[model samples]
Structures are given as structure tokens and as C-alpha cells.
Target: MNARTGPLSDVRILDLTQALAGPFCTMLLADLGADVIKVEPPGGDMSRTMGPHPNDRAGTDYGGYFASVNRNKRSVVLDIKTDGGREAIFKLAATADAVVENAKTGVMDRAGIGYDRLRKIKPSLVYAAIRGFGDPRTGRSPYADWPAYDIVAQSMGGLVSITGPAGSDGFRAGPGVGDIYPGTLAALGVVSAIHAARRTGHGQFLDVAMYDAILTLCENIVYTYSRAGVVRGPQGNGTPVLCPFDVFRSRDGAVAIAAPGENHWAILCNAIGRPELIADDRCRNNPKRVANAEFVREAVSAWTTAHTTQEIVAAIGGRVPVGPVNTAKDIFADPHPRARGMLIEVDQPGDNPPLTIAGCPIKFTETPSGIYARAPLLGEHTEQILAEAGITDASKEKS
Candidate 1:
């Protein structure tokens, strides 16, 4: 890949985020060719000790969780508690194009590197902050000061209420959408801010709440609450709005079949050799199907179980919108996913066969994505970043 094009190729980001959301955001920017400097405390970010370790050693610092989101960025350790560390951060910020932080609302301010002060120092900077609930000005909520992880955000953000089985407790999404979604949104805001700063020489505050972002993906709940005056709960795999959208057990594994509109329902009926259902008054239209969803699911499941995942998919995939409930391995083998570069083999510095990680979901024809570097070791670029700041350890040696 003779690559020299990215959406944010020229942008430089000073990343002060930890855990999921902030790191995921910067990873996308890094994918788009930005120079992302990942900052940590003198010891390291706490997530370095997260689970799914590369080495089985009990106290190992390299977790796959950290690796997944922190790729394509350089790490530098600077303790905010110390004057020298704060000075170093200010120096780095002086020349940075954007700063992404996920500290509690006032933590950055306490450290003397809040957005207000930094923006004054460098007017065109993009200052993005991802916090638990929001800035203090946000609407009333009890957990404003309490630190939030993904599950907490999912619960309050309204995603938990409608997920999982119909009678069971609310379940969190399989992936950390609560974390990654906000980070992605914050990164977009950062880019927008960077763009505006480039034109106006003025920096604006960028704040993203995990709860708010997760709610954006749960638009259906708001509609159900408003229009139907109903509180939806764990519908399991089935959607309240569409019939036969649920996952059904198949001979091998499981398959998900959706027949949302009339045409799709008709196509699905035709594929299952049940065109009679197309004329049935109880199943003719979307509302009727939704109302009679249980009957429809059982009927579709009976047909789907007789065939393999591929066979069922072949019968009604594009025509009626159906899919097999594929596991991770299945996804890797799928033809379209491979062609789209959704799974790319990344070589761990010296590891053979390389570790395979998911590629960016977004695509661009002329400006394609390229990820050349792996996640940085702790403080991997401390000296280099300090050097770029035009100050070196030579002065500290005298002290």
C-alpha cells in the first residue's frame, strides 16, 4: 500500500484519554493519518493492567483490551501531580492541533491544563472532553460525580431497557458501544473543531457524554415511549417493530431472518415456499406481521432449521434481508467481509502470522485507510515528544 492519504493526515492529536471511549476515538483519527500522542501518568494508564493479557503472567501489563483501542498512537508518561509534568504537558499542548481527554469534569482544570486555559494559549486548538455524565451544566442526574464504566452508561442511556430476552433483565450490548460510540462521536467533534479552528483561529470546547451518545443509537425507545406510551423491555433478539427479525435455532448454529416491509415479507414467504402467508390477512402487512410476530417467527424457524446457515442465507439474504448468526470465526470466513477489509492482519512488532484485528468499518475510495504501526509501549515516545517540544532532559539533569 503506497499510501499517503488520510482524512486527517495533517492533524496532530494529544490524547489524554484512558479505557475505551477516548482511545477508540483517537484510534480512528490515527487510522485517518493523524499523529496521535497518547499521554499517560508516570506509571501508566490503569487499562494497561486490564484483562485478556498477551502473556499469561498474572500481573502482566499488556492486555488485548488496551491493544485493541490504542493502536497507531505514541505513548508518553507525565505525572500531572508534579510541576515539571504539568509544564511538559503545556509545552506539548502549545504546538498540538487537538487534545482529547476523558478525565472527570474538573480533573483537567485541577491539573492546570483545562480547555479554557489551553485554548487561550493556543486559540486554534481543538479541545475535546469525554466525561461520565457531562459538564456541570447538563440536566439533573444523580451520577454526575460518580465515575462511569460502560455498563453504567448503557443502563442510564436507555439501551439496557430494551435489550436481552423479553422477560429477563436488561442486558448490555455485546461490544462496549457505550464507550466506543461516544469516543467516535467525540472524535468527529474534535475534527469539526479542528476544521473550524483552522478557519477562524478560535478553539471551542468539545464535550461528549457516554450516556447521551448511547441514547442516540436507541432512537426506537424514544419513539416507543412517545408514540405508544409503552416502556419496552428485553425483547431478546426479536424487534418490537418487525416480525421474524429474531434469531432462530438452526441445524448447525442459528440464523437471523428479517422481513420488515411488505416486499421483504413477500420475498421471505416466497423463499420459504409459503406464499400463502402473503395473502393471509394476519400476515399481509408490516403491522399485521408485527402484531402476529410470534406466529410468524415459529413458521420461519421451522423452514430455516431444515437448511444450513448458507442454505438459508442463499434463499432469502438480499431478497428478504436475512443473515446467519455467525460467530467471530464465521465472520472471518465470510466472503464480503474479507473483500471489504473488515479484518486485517496486523503484525505485532516481531510476532509471526501477526495478530488479526478488526479493520475500520468506514471506507474511502481515493483516500484509503492504512495502519502501519502497532500500539505503543508505555512512554515509548516520551523523549521524542519532549524533543519535539524543543525541551530535553539535559535541563532536568542539571536540577
Candidate 2:
């Protein structure tokens, strides 16, 4: 294992999570130097089979989906339903600072390894859960028993209601923000609870609901409805409150431009060779420009459509806020990601070439965080982990 060196180096986390949301939360902790032990079932994580595998590594144990989020962790297989498995978990929990999982409400409790059971062995163990709704221990929801995924959370949480073009049903975001955001919140909760446990000699149970996370992401709509009694729908790429704050067609591609502030608006007008519009009543202030958004959009579009994205950026890049729409290819070619160490290259299983995954965004000067190791194979460290925890008979459950 790579030498752990970061803010969380001293923390030990028992990661009983699979799939994106739970894994994502633990990934953050692992990246920050936490000793995250990923406890997998007999069949391994379902995402192990969810792939975009390297063409040459068809028999690889996991694919991009699993590797991306499970990096920097050790894997140990255990059948928690068995008495030996349950004993192994209890032993691990006795030394763990936290335990994280994303199963449905009662799944862990039914298996006899839930927070209530583990807290008895280690009272200072922080137990964090991520569920579609929320755990009943915190608050019960009518849909607590219902299963949910990213799309379901987005739709029910109001995100899909305010996305995409106006006049049509909104679109789901391309990425799984529903799972990711909840996972992020759960990670935060685990860390905070661990800190409290250290000081107070007590641990607690916490949970993050995917639905609640998406609702928080779309917080603007709630205040809008409550304050103005306005049910805001999708405004497309441009918002209703800002003028000239939208993507415009450039000669080669599209570029986003925001000029809601007076100075920025003036700078934008000058860059587009339309300085006279700065003093025009219809476009002078932000509100007036928003009221005449169509005209303003057309004027900005007319100028943008004539210039290449690069040219437009060069004209007002520093003076105003602007960025060209970047695709995966563009991002790979960009220097920023490379300079900031956002793209990480890691070895793949088999004889395949190394692959690049996203790097940790969190940066600390004294103790830097990074991808020190690749994702572990299923049960890769089962023997080592079990031995370290003094678990002997649990090895019989591994298949």
C-alpha cells in the first residue's frame, strides 16, 4: 500500500458501501488519506460488472465505473449474513472510527450489523448511511422503503423541473448529482461525527437522503415560489434574472458569457463594439436588459456568431467572465486540468495500458492528498485485512 499522507491519515473508515453514491463518499475520505476498508459481499459490488473496460482487458475484475470511485481503498469480501461474517464486522468496527453504507433503510439492521448493534461494540463508532429517502432513526418518510436512483431523485427533488429548454418537460442532468451530492454530504457528516466522538467519547448515527440532496441543489426554486408565489420553470441556458448571461453561438462553437454587473456589462459592450448600448435605456441596467432579454440576446448573438470562440475569449476573457463549452476531448487537451493535476493516470489490470481517472480536487499544503494507489481487485486484501483485525474463521466465507 502507498504511504498514507494527508489530513485523514489517522482516521480509519469501514466502507460497507457499493455503487456510485456510497463509494463516492468513501472515495473522498480515502483520497484524503483515510484507511478506508471496503467490505464487499460474496458477489462483489454490482458496479464491478458495470463497465467501459479496456478492449484488451476484457477479463478484468472491474471496469471504469467501479475503478473510478473505488480507488485508494482495500477490499475485503465477507458474507455478513453468516455468524463468522458478522463477527468479523464486529471486530473491525471495534477499531473503526466510522462506518458508511448506502443500503435501503432496514437492510443493515436486518443483517444484524446496523448502527445499533455496532455501537454496542464501539460506542464511539460513527455510523453514516445514505438512503434514497432517509433512515427512520432520523425521520421517517412515506417513501423510505421505496428504492431510488439518480434519475428518480432528480425528478422528485425539483432539479428536473427547472432544467432544459422552456415549454417542454425538463431534462435530467447528464451526471448523477443525486447520488454524488448525497454521498458528499454523508462524508461530511461522518467526518464531523468522528470529530465529535473524539472529544465527547460518544458516536452517533447520521444519514443523507438522495432526494434531500437534490432538493438542496435546487434550493433557488423553493425561495422563488415562497417569496414571489411564482412557480419557476426551465429558463433554458439563460436565466430570467440576468441579461447577456447565456451561451452564444461563436463562429466555431458556443461560449458562455455573463455580464450582469454594470462594469462587466460595459466591458462586454465595448468588446462587442456596441458601446452605445451601455447608455441605452433598454439595456443600461441589469433589470432593463432582462426585461428586453430577447433584443439583448440577439445583439450579443450577432456579435458572437461573427467571431470564433477563441477570438471572443481573447477580446474580453480577463475583463469579463467567459468560457467556451468544453467536451471531454477539449478537457483532455486543455492545459488547466494538466497543470492542476486533475487528470490522474493509473495502472490497469492485465497487460492493458494505464488509464486516466479524475484526481482529488482537495489540496492541502502541509499534507497533500492524491491518488496513491489504483482500485483494488475484489477481495484483494481479504487475507491481510482479516489477519490485521484478528479475524480467522471469517476466511471460510470467502469464495
Candidate 3:
């Protein structure tokens, strides 16, 4: 852990992202051993003000939102508008394998350090972007200049059209999948672009539009409409093609049980002490069960409601696909997370206790990757990072 490690340990990245989408993407690179230097503006990433800050740890230094996505990276404050700051960024970019940013369409170009200008400094430098719509470099969007956030992306991307209960108004997802999915895709694009650059000695500009990513994530909708003339709508916890694949209420809470397959349906039927149900004409095949969805749902619900989550798991787990709808407390108490190292504990600066954030799920058998550093305080490594970039302008940093 002491030594520089990870699959991308040798790769340096100049990160100019703020808020969730950009930072989340760079964080993935940082987790995988990329030396990601987060170049923040004088005021810091906007997420610094977002909270769940500990009562005893209130400060401008950090907050929960920033900490969650900005771990394992260094921060360097820079005002892109300043002459010296732009010079410093170019110097950093000269040495970086890639540059990633989520600024509006023309913000970077207006600052004079956009991909077109940066690639001139390093011909083989990969430039990746995450935007609400998309950059004109790839394809012009009608709303390219309009500002957007997670909600905007989710709404415009067609996710909100088919998201909630089949009869009720659609709901945005609890998590920022609108941003997170695009960020995840951006990370993959960056790495792939870099791989091609290493081979061709030339880099390219790539982007992930938040709206585009969401549409891609909901791909089934497109095909359903195109192939069947059906505009898919949410069926709440179950889908139109599957019966007994909904969230069932246990005595204590809820668990999702998907037993649409023939063998699985048989196993679940026997487990519920109603083996005869499986052979019934109305439930004999997936299509029939789906057609009689209400009957299957009611029968399954009746069984699940009589049992606690644990009992339901004991009866159907491993034999069929079943999982409790866990809360944070439940996840903390669960042994699976611990065994898989899903939750990582990191040190906090003040009197607050150590904070636990999600760990990287990507596992490499030969190459090691993980969180190695806590989220940096604003401008905490300004001087150090500038020095490493061979830019002697730490004095010009305002924050």
C-alpha cells in the first residue's frame, strides 16, 4: 500500500471535473492506480458545499458528497482564466496520459485549454468529456449550451417516461444514475482511447452525453417499441414479461424474488408448499403466468407476507434469485459486504470518526487496485502537484 500501485499506476491524469459526473469518472481512474490530479477552481468543486457533514467536523475543508467521489486523488486549485493557471494546466497536460473534464460545451475552449489546444501540446494525450447533452466536437446538440444536472439528464433521456409504477407517474431513480452511468462510460472511453493512443501514437476526443448514456441504459425501451409497437411502461417491481418477479413483502420488510424460469418456478412453488400451483394451466408456462400476473403475484405475496425476510431467504435463496431490499444499516450488518470488501473505511481529519465509503468493485487477479488516499482538502496539494508538473507557479494559486 505504501508504494505507488494499481493498473494505471504509470498513467497520469489531469482531472478538471466538478460535482458528481466528472469527479465520479476520475475517481474510478484514481481507484485503479492512475495519478489523477484534480484541478479545481478557486472556489473548489461545487459539491464541497453539499453535505451530510459530521456534527463535530464542520469545515470548508470537506463534506460527505465531495468525500464520497473524490477519494484517492490529489487536488490542485487553479483559476483557468488566469494566464499562469492556464500555463500550469498545459504543463500538467503535457505530462499526462489523458485529460478529463465535464465543463459546458465551450467553457474549456473559452479558457484556452480545451482538447484542440491541449492535443497540440501532447499529440498522444487522450481527452475525455462528460456533458449533459454532448460536445459539438462529437456531434452538435440543440441544447449544447443549456446547463443541465442529474434530473435534467434523466428526464430528457427517456428514463422518466418508463420508470415508476405502470399506472402511476414515473419517478426518477433514487441514485444519480443519470450522472453515474455517463461517468462510468466516460471512464471506459478514456481508457479505451488511451489504449488506441498507445498503439497509434495519436489521441482522440471522446464524450459521453448524460442523456445518451441514460437512453443506452434503458435500451430495452427502444427495441420494444420498434419490434412490437409497444411503448414500454414501468410495471412497478415486476415486468410485463415475467410473473412472480416482483418485490414481495416479508413480515419485516421486502425482498425481490424472480422465479420466472421453469425450474425456478417449480422450486419456488414447492418451497411455498404449493407444488400443485406450478402444474396449473394458468401458471404452466412463463407466458401464461405473465398473462395471469395478478394471480401469481397474489399467491407469491401471500406466502412472502407470512414469512420474515430471513425465512423467505432460507426457503428460496440459492435455489432461486432472491435478495432482501436492504437499507444502509442492513448492508453494514451484512457479512457479504465485509467479505467482499465492498465498504472501505477512510480517515477523517477532525474529531469525527472514520468515514466509510464504497470500494471499487473491479477485481484484477494479477493487478491490484483500490482506494489508497483520502479525499484531498481544497488546494491541499496545490504546491506539491505544481512542483511535480515542473510548473513553478504555486505562488499564483489563489486558494
Candidate 4:
């Protein structure tokens, strides 16, 4: 099953990205059956060195971080700083439907292979970039030149401002949402631009800034501040507007329970043996419950703490919006992921055992998408990819 098999099988993409944001965007395309050719420098993507490596596999070229996102793509080595390398990129772009990168503002332009140059070779190419701030062509920022990572974007974009415990400095999320959200948006932008280019016979440049994407994710802050002059603070686990919409303690672990609607609230009240609270004046409705949030929380917590996480889930899992806070261990033991195909196993390089990674979530009735190949060894497909692109001579230098 080496042949591509999804809706994007007809499309080809040149991936000149590294690390999370850029690679993640291209990964989505590859999973959807786009023939993504990853153009790597001689040393390969920096993430190849990042670990959670196989415990027994020594001298492995790549680790879980690289494997997780680079699946279903071919890799080619190129030293874009050289004439031969630049020529190879041009040749590849000429046959590609799109080019995606996550370099800083002027990095690609200085190398002489930026979107401006690539678009000339393939006028219908969708050129997309992911940056810490934004590309100057779209809108220049004062901090455009400054380098940023996940934490920086999360802080500057207002996500960290309204997260974590109330009355204290905000907490960074467990995952790199700053990069992931921006990457997800870039994937959407790429698909949209490709659709437009196919229709209009002209491609355009699109960019997703990490800071901007994070801001969009925290959109509620913008409207709340603008409409009511209210600077929302850290909300902790629960929102200020909704009562009984939080993670409560259980004997074994924690479970998230939300019953903000009238009917759900009544159902929850009966389930927790607090039926009289449904008619109580201070906690009768959603608004009143919000006003007396402490009382409501104590009431829910009192019942939840006495039972196990699974017990609470069993009581109201389907009737109300409730679920336990699941860790990786719990997820591995659960049957839902297995039924949904949300976990997949693929072999690794060297003598390592097969590794499991999260699977693609998008589902299609006819054209299903999934991981079909493991991540390539550094420049694994260089000769084949170059030949496919009709490039007879190209530099394979590490620089």
C-alpha cells in the first residue's frame, strides 16, 4: 500500500519546515495523502535529535518527536545556500502544488529561495509560512525580528494570561498549544489557498503567526474586555460564567463534570442526592448558581470526593457532560481510542520496537486518511526524489 490513497492524493507539496509548527502543518497534508517531499538540510531537522528515544536503540538518527509528525513523507537533502541546492528547490517547486515553511521572516528570502522566487516557477503554487510574529509582506510587527518559541507566543498572545489558578501568575499549558494551534491553522490556510488557486489559476501567499493564532484561540478575552471593559483574570479550571463546570476530586482521581443547563442541573442534583438544591432560591438557575458558585462547587465536590472517578463517570457520563481526567496510562487502557483508531503503531529505525503515536482525527466516509509509512532516515529519499523532479545534479552538502 505504498500508493497514496486519500482526497489529497492528487496534490503534491514541498515541505521546507523543521521542528513542530511547520512540520505539523505538512504532516496533516501528508496524512491526507498529499505527496509531501520534505526538503532537509544536510544535518536534517533539529527535532531528529530531540528524544524519548527507544531505550535499547543506540545511535538512532531520530526519536519520537521527529517520528510523531514526519510520517508519510519522503525526505531529500539540499544545501539551499548553494547554487545547486537552490536550483534543486526551484525544480521541485515547479512541480509542487504548494511550499510550506516555518523559518523566521527573512531567513528564506536571504537564502534566495523564498516565496517570491518560488511563485515565479509555479504561479499556481500556494506558498504558506508559519512565523513567531508574522511575515512583513502581510503586516510587519515591531517584534518581527525577535525570535520566539512556544512559551513566548503563549505569553504574548494572552493564553497564559487567563489560564492557571486565579490571583497568581498564569501557568503554561502542558502541551505546546502555541505551536500546535498555529500549525493547525496553517494547514487550514494551505488547503483553502490550494482550493482557490485551482479555481482561479493563480496562487497567493498566506502566513500564520504563532502569537496571532494563540490570540485567536483566546478570543473570549478580546470580546469581554472590549464589550464590558473587564480584564478577565486567570480562571483556573472553571469558567466564571458557568457553575458546576469544573474538575472535582474523586477518591481515586479527578473527573470533569458540567451541568450548566436547567435540565442537566436537575438531573445532576438528583444523581448526587441533592434534589432539594434544584428548587433552592440561591441555586435554582444557571445565573443564580454562578452567583453562588462556591456553594455549588462544594456541593458537587462533596459527592464526587466520596466516589471513585469511574463511579462518578458511570453515574452521569451519558446523561450529563462528564468525564474523568485521563492520563496517557488511562488512555492506553481505554477502549474508545482502539475503536476510533486514535492510536497507531509503526516500526522504528535501528533495532527498536514499534512505537505508538496519536492518529489523525479527521474522518471521511469514502477517502480515509492515516499513517502509511514511518519517518525517513535523514535524506532517505534524496536520490529518488531528485530523480522524480528531473534534477540530474544537485548539491548534497551539509551546509
C-alpha lDDT of candidate 2 relative to the true structure: 0.92
Each candidate structure's TM-score, on Cα atoms with residue i matched to residue i, is 0.93, 0.98, 0.97, 0.97
Off by over 4 Å in 4: 56-59, 393-399
**lDDT against the true structure, each candidate:** 0.81, 0.92, 0.89, 0.91
lDDT of 1 at 30: 87
Alpha carbon lDDT at 136, candidate 2: 94
* Model 2 ranges off by over 4 Å: 393-399
Give a tens-digit lDDT track for model 2, residues 1-399: 689897999999999998999999999999999999999998999999887887766446898999899999999998998888888899999979999999999999999999999999999999999999999999999999999999999999998999998886998998999899999989899999999999999999999999999999999999999999999888889998998889899999999999999999999998889999999999999999999999999999999999999999999998999999999999999999999889999998777778899999999999989897899999999888988998766355542
List pairs with backbone clashes in candidate 4.
Answer: none
Q: On a 0 to 100 scale, what is the lDDT of residue 170 in model 2?
A: 94
Query: Which residue pairs does candidate 3 place in steric collision?
Result: none
lDDT of 3: 0.89
Best by lDDT: 2
Model 3 residue runs over 4 Å out of place are 56-60, 393-399
What is the C-alpha RMSD, rounded to one decimal, of candidate 3?
1.6
Alpha-carbon RMSD to native, per candidate: 2.5, 1.3, 1.6, 1.5
| Count of backbone collisions within predicted model 2 | 0
